[model samples]
Target: MQELKIERLVKRYPGRDQVIAVNHVDVEVQAGEMLVLLGPSGCGKTTLLRCVAGLEDAQEGRILLEGQPVFDASSGMNQPTHLRDIGMVFQNYSLWPHMTVQANVEYPLRARGAKADDRARRAAEVLEVVQCAHLSDRIPAMLSGGQQQRIALARALAPRPKVMLLDEPLSNLDALLRVELRAHLRAIHRELGFTGIYVTHDQIEAFNLGTRVAVMNAGRIEQLGSASQVYERPATEYVARFLGIRNSLAIDPQGGWHAGPTPLAGDLGRLDQHQGPMQLYVRPPSVSVLPADAPAPGPGQIVLSGARVKDVLYAGGEIDFVVELGQATLYATMRVGGAAPRASDPVRIQFASSDALLYRNGQLIDG
Candidate 1:
C-alpha cells in the first residue's frame, strides 16, 4: 500500500494562446483507500489523473508517491509512466486485438523481464482475481465489453503496481453492465487494498465507489468530503442545483413577498448579512402536501394554501407530485404507501425552517 499526493498541479497548453486545463489542483490519496475525482465533462479530472500516473507532464506542482517525489517541474524530475509503478485502466478497454486474454495479462510482467513460467503463473493468478481465468485463451474480439474490461483490469493488476488510476472505466458499458462492473470493481478494491484514484462524471458511481469524493468544476475543486456531507450540506448553489435540488424561492428579510392571500412571513430568518435578494433551497422530499381541509400546523412550519396539483408521476417506490403555489411550481415526493392527492386538487403545502437552505448571489448564506 502506497499513498499518492499531488500538490499545486497545473497543466497548460501553449499555442497561439494559452489554455489552462488543470489549475493548481491538490489531491491526496491514503494508502489502501479509493479517492474519486468527480465533476462534469471537460472539468480537468482526467488531465489531473494523467499527471498522477506520469502520463502527462504538469507545468507546475509535485507528484509524490509514498513520500518520494516522482514529478517536480522546478527540479526537472519527471518519472516515465512505466517507471512510476502505476497501473492505468482507460475508458476504452486497451486490450491487444490479436493477443489472447492470457497473453495480454502476461504482457506487463513480461515487460518487467519476469521469467516465462513466472509471467504465466502471475497472469493466471490475476485473471482468477478478476474472474476471467476461464476465458484466458479467448481473443479480445471474442469477449463482451464487461469481459474485456475484466481482462484489462487483470493486466493492470498483474504487475502489482503501487497505485492504480481508472479513467471512467465503466462509462461505455450499458446501464446494467455498468452497475455489475461497478460492484466488481468495488470488490476488487476491497480484496486488494490498493491505492486507487478514479475519475468519473457519474455522481451515482462516485457515491457508490469513492471513500471520499472531490467535486470539481471549471478546473477547480468546489468541495471535497464524504458523500452525505456534500449532498446534505452543499457549500455552493451550483452544487445544490446541479445535484437535482428543484425548490428554490426568493426570501426577503423585510417581509417583502406576498403570495395571494398569504403574506410571506419575515420571521423565517435574518437575511441582513446576505447581499441583494436571498433565495431558499429545499429538497423535494422535505416538502409535504396536506389536504385542503386539514388544520394548520402549530409552529416552525410555513403553511401555504390555494396550491393546485399540476401533475402526479408514479415512480417505482414513490409518488411525485408537481404543485403550483401561487405562480411558482414546487415538487414533492411521497412514498407509494402514503395517500396521494389527485391532480388539479387544491392542497396545503408545508415545510420546516431547517429543511430550507438560504442562498444569495448563487452562494450559500448562513440562516
Candidate 2:
C-alpha cells in the first residue's frame, strides 16, 4: 500500500512575464484512492502532475511517498525520476511504434533490471488486465486509439509503481471510446488497488474516475471534495460556473433577488440576513415544471409563479426548456414526455430552496 503527500508545491516559469504554473498546492492521496485534479487548459493541473512525476522541477516544497520524502527543497534534495517508483500515463499514448505491445509493456520492468522471465511475466499479466493480451503481438501503429490507450495503461501498471499519475489519458479517444475506457480504468484501479492522481479538463472523466476531485484555477486549488459534493454543492462562484450551473441571482440583505433585469423574492434562510453581495445558483435538473393550478408550498420548495416558456429544445434523450422568469432566462433539462410547453406559453417553475447553492467569491456560504 502507498500514500502520497505534497506540501506547499510551487512551480514557476521565469520569462519576460514570469508565470507561476503551479501555485503553493498541497494534496494527499491514500492507498487505493484515485484523486483527480480537474480544471481548464491553463489551470496548472498538468504542471502539478508533472511535478509529482519528477518530470518538472519545483522552486519550493516537499513530496512524500509512504512517509519518505522524495522532494525536499529546504534540503535541496530531489529524487531522480528513475528512482521515484512512479508510473506515468501521458495524454498521448507514448507507445513505441516499432515495438510490439508486449515489448512496450515490458520496458518498465526491463529498465528496472528485472530478469527476462520476470519482465515477460509482468508484462503479460498487465496486458491481460488491460484486456489487450490478444493484441500483444501487434505494433501501436496498427492499433486503434482505444487499443493504444489500453497498451499505454498496461505499460504504466506493468511495474506496479507505488503511485500512478495519469495526465488526460483518454482525451484523444473518441467519445464512445472515452466512455468505455473510463469504466475499464475504474475497474482496473479497484482490482489492483493502486494509489493514483489523474489530471483532466473533462468533467465527466473527473467525476466518474476520481474518488475525490480537486478543482484548480490560475495555479491554485479552488476546491477539493467528493464528486457529488463538488458537482452538487460547489463552494465557489468559479466552481459553480465551471460545473455549468447557470441559474444565478444576486441578492441584497433585504431578500430582494436581482434575477436579471427584474427583482424576485429570495429566501436564503440564514444567508438573507445582513447580506452584502451574494450569488445563488439553482441546478437545472432541480428546476421542475409546476402544475397549472398552484400547489401548496411543499417542503423546501421555492416557486416562480409567472415564468414563460421561451423555447423547448429536443436533444436526443432529453428536452431542454428555455424558461424566462421575468427578464431572466434559465435552462432546465427534463426527460422526454415531461410537461413541456410550447414557445411563448405561460409556465411556472419550482425547485427546492435547499437545492439552491449559495456562493460568494467562489466559496460556498453555508447557511
Candidate 3:
C-alpha cells in the first residue's frame, strides 16, 4: 500500500529573488519503505519533506497519508502539522534539555491525551527498540550525542506515527558516530517496519538507509531508483556528478570522444544508433592508467594513449592519479603498494566501454 503520496507539488517564495522550492514533484512512498530524498543544500528536498509534514503550505499539490488527504491545494484543505500524525527527527536531536529521556520519549503520546501509564509503556517499548532504554533516567545534557539522537528517534517512534520524517538527523554527529548511528537507524527501521522519508545530502547515508533514493536538483527530482541503480547507472549528468562519477567527456556526432583537444579511443559499435552530440560519463574507479608502452587493449575497451600523469595522491587504501589528456584532466585510482607513478610520467588511460554512461540532451541513452 502507498503510505504517502505527493502529487504535482509546487512551492515558491514570493519576492524579487523568488525561488521555486519544489516544482511539480510527484512521489509515492510504499508502506514500510524508507524513501530517501538525496540532494545537496538548496535542492528543495527539505522543503518537500516540510510540505509533507504540513510545515510548509505549497501553492499547488495534494499530499495524502495512507489514502487520506492531508493537504489539497485545489480544495483549499490544509491539515495542520500536529494533525498530520508525522514524527520528525531533526538534525539537532531536538530533545528537551531539562526533561528526562523517559519524559522526552513519552511527550508526544502525552500530548495526544494518552493515559500516563500508556505513555510510559509506549516510551519504554520504543526506547528498547532504539537501544536507549538504559538512558531513560538521564536528562538530554547527560547523554552523549549518539545517545541523545537515539532518544530522539525513540521519542519519534513512541507515538507509532503513520509516517516518520527525518531531516538529516545524523548530520550533527561526528563521522564515526554518524556511521555507528546509521547502522542503528537501519536496524531499527528493519525491526519496526515504519514508513519513512529521510532527507540527507550524504550519498553513503542515502545508499545505506533508503529502499529507494530520489536524487533532487534545483527544486526537482533528477533521478529516482534503487541505490545500485542510481550509483551504477545515473539517469542524468547532475546525478552522475553528484554520485561521484566525475569523468564527463564529450562524444562528437562521428562517435569520437574527447575531454579537451585530445581524442580518446572507445568502441563505437553502440553509438551507431545515437545521433548528434552525446556526453559520456564514467567513474574514477572505472578508469585505469597504465605505462604508455603497455600492450594494446582487447576489444570493447576504451584506451587513451599518450596521457601524462599530472599528479598522484595517496588516499587511504587507494592512490589517486590525476592524468592529463591534452587540456582536460581525468582522475583514476588504483590500489596502493604498487610501484607509484610519478608526475610527468607518460601513461595511457583505459576503461571498459561497457562501463561508460552515455547521455544525449541531458538524458541517458538506453543501452
Candidate 4:
C-alpha cells in the first residue's frame, strides 16, 4: 500500500527575483519503506520534506498521507502540522533542555491527551527500545549528543506516527557516532517497520539507510532508484559526478576520445552504433595509474599513455594519484604499494571498458 504520495508539487519563494524551490515533483513511498532524499544544499529536498509535514504550504500540489489528503492547493485545504500526525527528527536534536528524558519522550503523547498511565508506559517502552532507559531521569543538558538524539528519536517513536520525517538527524554528530547511530536507526526501522522519509546530503548515509534513494538537483529529482542502481549506473552526468565518477572524457564520431583539447589514446571498442559526440565516465577506483613503462593492460581494457602524476595524496591505506594528461586532470585511487609513483613521475592510466559508462546528451547509452 502507498503510505505517502506527492503529486505535481511546486513551491516558489518571493524575492527580488522569484525562486522555485520545488518544481512539479512527484513521489510515492510504499508502506514500511524508507525513502531517502539525497542531494546537495539548496536543492529543495528540505523544502519538500517540510511541505509533507505541513510545515510549509506549497503553492501547487496535493499531498496524501495514508490515503488522506493533508495538503491540496487546488481545493485550498492545507492541514496544520500538528493535525497531520507526523513524527519529525531534526539535526539539532530539538530536545527540551529543562525536561527529563522521560518527560521529553512523553510530551507528544501528553499533547494528544493520552492517559497518564498510557503515556508513562509508552515512554518507558520507547526509552528502553532506544537503550536510554537508564538515563530517563537525566535532562537533555546532562546527556551526550548521541544520547540526546536517541531520546529525540524515542520521543518521535512514542507517538507511533503514521509517517516519520527525519531532516539530517545524524548530520551534527561526530563521524564515529554517526556510523554507530546509523546502524541503530536501520535496525530500529527494520524491527518496527515504520514508513519514513530521510533527508541527507551525505551519500554514504543515504546508501546505508535508504531502501530507495531519490537524487535531487536544482529543485528536481535527477534520478531515483536502489542504492546499487544509483551508485553503479547513474542516469545523468550530474548524478554521475555526485556519485564520484570524476574521470569524464569526450568521444567523437570516429571513435576518438579527448579530454578538452588534449587527445586521449584508447580504442573504446564497440562504439559503431553510438552516433555523434558522447561522453565516457569512469570512477577513480576503476582507473589504474601505473608507471609509463608498464606493460599494456589485458584485453577489454583501454589504456592511455603520456600522462604525468602531478600530485599524490596519502590516504592511509590508499593513495590518490592526481594525473595530468595534456590539459585534463584525472584522479586514480589505488592501494599503497611499493610501486607507487611519486609526483612529477611519468604514468599511464587504464580501465576496463565494462567499467566505463557512455552517455550522449546527458543520458546513459545502452550497450
Candidate 5:
C-alpha cells in the first residue's frame, strides 16, 4: 500500500487579492485504506482532492504519493492528471454516449498501449468487479442510473490506478440505489485492497465508508478522527451541529443551565471564560423522555416536567418527538416499539450531565 501525504497545501484562485479556495491544509492517507474528505459545499474538499489528483496546481506546499513528489510549488513541479496513476469517479457519470460499456471501459487500457486482447480481458475483469459485466455491450443511454455509475467505476478501475478518487459518487442515485451501491463499493474495495479518498457532504456516508473522516469548513479542516470520535467528541460547535446535534440551552453564570423547570449541571463559569454567552448542547438521542408520573431521582440531572408533545415523527428504529417546554420547543428521540408517549400529552424530559456539551460563542469549550 502506498502512502499519500499533503504538506501545507494551499490553492488560491486569481482574483482581487486572490480568492483562497483551499487554505494551508495537511493530511496523510495510508495505502489500501479509505479516507473521506467530508464537508458542506465550497469547503475546499474538492479543491484538495483535485490538487492531490494533479488536476489543479497548488499555490503552496506539496503533495507526495509514496514519497514521490506529485505537486510542489516551491520546486515548480506539477504532474498531469493522466500521469498521476489515479482513477477519478466524478459525481456525473462521464460515460461516452457513442460507445458501449465495454468500449468505454477498454479505452483507458488501450490508451496505455495494451494489446487489444489484453485490453478486452482487463475490461471484462473490471466490469465483472463492478458487477456490470452483463451490460458490457449495452450503451450507457440504455442503462439504469446505478448501472451507469457501475460502468463509470469499471472504467476508472480498468487501468488499475494506484489511487482511487471519488467525488460524491452516489449522490446521483436514488436512496435505495445509493445504499446498494455503497455496499457494493465497499465490497469491491475490500476485494482489490485499493487506496481511496472519497469526497462527500453526506455525514452518514462518510461515517460508514471512511477509515478516517476529515471535517472541513470555510476552506479549513475543523476536525479529523474516527467516526465515533468525531460524533461523540467534536472539537467545535460547527462540527457538533453539523453532525446533527439539536438541543442547545443557555448556561447561567452559576455553572448550570435551566432545562424548563430543572437545572442541568455544567461548568458555565469555565465556559464563560472563553467568549460570548455560554450554552449547552445535547444530541436528541441522548435526551430521555420519561413518564409524567415518574419520580424525581438524582442530582445533576436536567429534567423538564410538563413538556407537552407537539408532534411525533416515526423514524425507522426510533420515534422523534417535538416537545414543547412552555414557550421553548425541543426535540428528542426514543427507540421505536419500546415505549411511546402520546402527542399533546405531558411528559418529563431528562438528560444526564455527561451527555451535555458546553459551547460559548459558537465554539465548544474545553472541559
Candidate 6:
C-alpha cells in the first residue's frame, strides 16, 4: 500500500510582497485513496496539487510518497516531476492533434526508453482500461471531446503511476459528459488503486469523486472530511454559503439570535457561550413548510407564522417555494406530489433548533 504525506507545505508566487498559493498545509492520503482538493477558482487548490506532483517548487515543506522523501525544503532536496513517478491529467485534454490515440497513450513508455512491443502492450492495456480501445487508431481530431479526454487519461495511466493528479479533468466537457467521465474516473481509481489528488471547483464533482475532501480557501484547508461531513457540517460560514445555504440570520452577543423581524423566544442553548455578532445557517431541506390547514408541531419545534409564498419554482423532483418570513425571504423544498403553495399563498414554516447551525468568528459554533 502507498501513502502520501505532506507536512507544513507552502508554495508562493513572486510578487510585490509574495502571493502564497499553499500555506502550511498538512494532510495525508492513504493507499487506494482519492483525496480531493476542492475550492473556488484562485483558492490555490491546483497550486497545492502541482507542488505535490513536483511541477511547482515549494518554498517550504516536506512531502513523502510511500515513506520516501520526494521533497524536503529543510534538506534542500526537490525531485523533478518525471522522477517523482506521478501521473497528471490537465483541465484540457492535452492530446497531440497530429498523433493517433495509441501513440499518445504510448508516449510516456517511449520517453522512458521502453521497447516498441512493451509500449504497444502497455498502451493497449490502458486504452482498454479507459474504454477507448475502439478509438485507439483515430487521431485526436477524429474523436469526440469525451474520447480525447479518455485517451489523455489513458496516457496518464499507461505508465501505471502510483500517484495520480487530475486538475479539473472534466471541466472542459459538457455537463452530461462531465458526469459521465466523473463516474468513469471513480471506477478507474477504484480498480487501479492509485493514491490520487483530484482538483476541481465544482462541488458535485468534489463530493462524487473524493474519498475524502480537503476544502481549500486562500491557500489553507478550511475543512477536511467525508462528503457528508463537509456538506452537512461545514466548518465555517464561508463553506455554508459556498454550499448554497442561504437561511442565515445574524446573532447578537447576548445569546440572542436575530431572525429578521422575527423574535428569538426559543432556547439559545450552545449559542449563548459565543461572542458578538454571529451567523445562523439553515439548509432549505431542513425547513418544513406546513399547509394552511396542517396542525402545529410538537414542543421544541420552531414555528414561524405570517409567511406568504413569494414564488414557486418546480425543480424536477422537488418544488422550491420562496416564502417571505417577516422581512426575510427563505426557500423550502417540497417533494413532488405534496401540497405546494404558489405565489401570494399564505404558508407556515417550521424547523427544529437542532437543524439551525450557528457560526461565530466565521467558524461553526453550534448546529
The prediction achieving the highest TM-score against the true structure is 4
For model 4 the TM-score comes to 0.97
Error of 6 at 351 (Å): 2.2
Q: Which stretches of candidate 3 lie over 4 Å from their true place?
A: 253-260
Instruction: Please give the lDDT score for candidate 6.
Output: 0.85
- Residues 102-130 of candidate 1 have per-residue lDDT tens digits of 99999999899999999999999989888
Q: List candidate 4 segments past 4 Å from native.
A: 255-267
Taken over the whole model, the C-alpha lDDT of each candidate is 0.84, 0.84, 0.89, 0.90, 0.84, 0.85
What are the RMSDs of all candidates, in order?
3.1, 2.5, 1.6, 1.5, 3.4, 2.6
| Model 4 per-residue lDDT tens digits across residues 74-176 | 9989999999878999999999888999999999999999999999999999998899999999999999999999999999999999899999999999999
Which consecutive 10 residues in model 6 have the weakest lDDT in total?
Answer: 263-272
Off by over 4 Å in 1: 15-18, 256-277, 298-302, 337-339, 360-367
Question: Model 5 scores what on Cα lDDT?
Answer: 0.84
Q: lDDT per residue, candidate 5, 20-78, as tens digits?
A: 87889988889888999899898888888899888888889999988899899999999
Candidate numbers, best lDDT first, in rank order: 4, 3, 6, 2, 1, 5
Q: For all candidates, what are the clash counts?
A: 0, 5, 0, 0, 0, 0
Clash number for candidate 4: 0
- Report the Cα lDDT for residue 358, model 5: 80
Q: Which of candidates 5 and 6 reaches a greater lDDT?
A: 6
Clashes of 2: 5
Cα lDDT tens digits, model 6, 162-209, are: 889999999989999999999999998888888899999889999999
lDDT of 3: 0.89
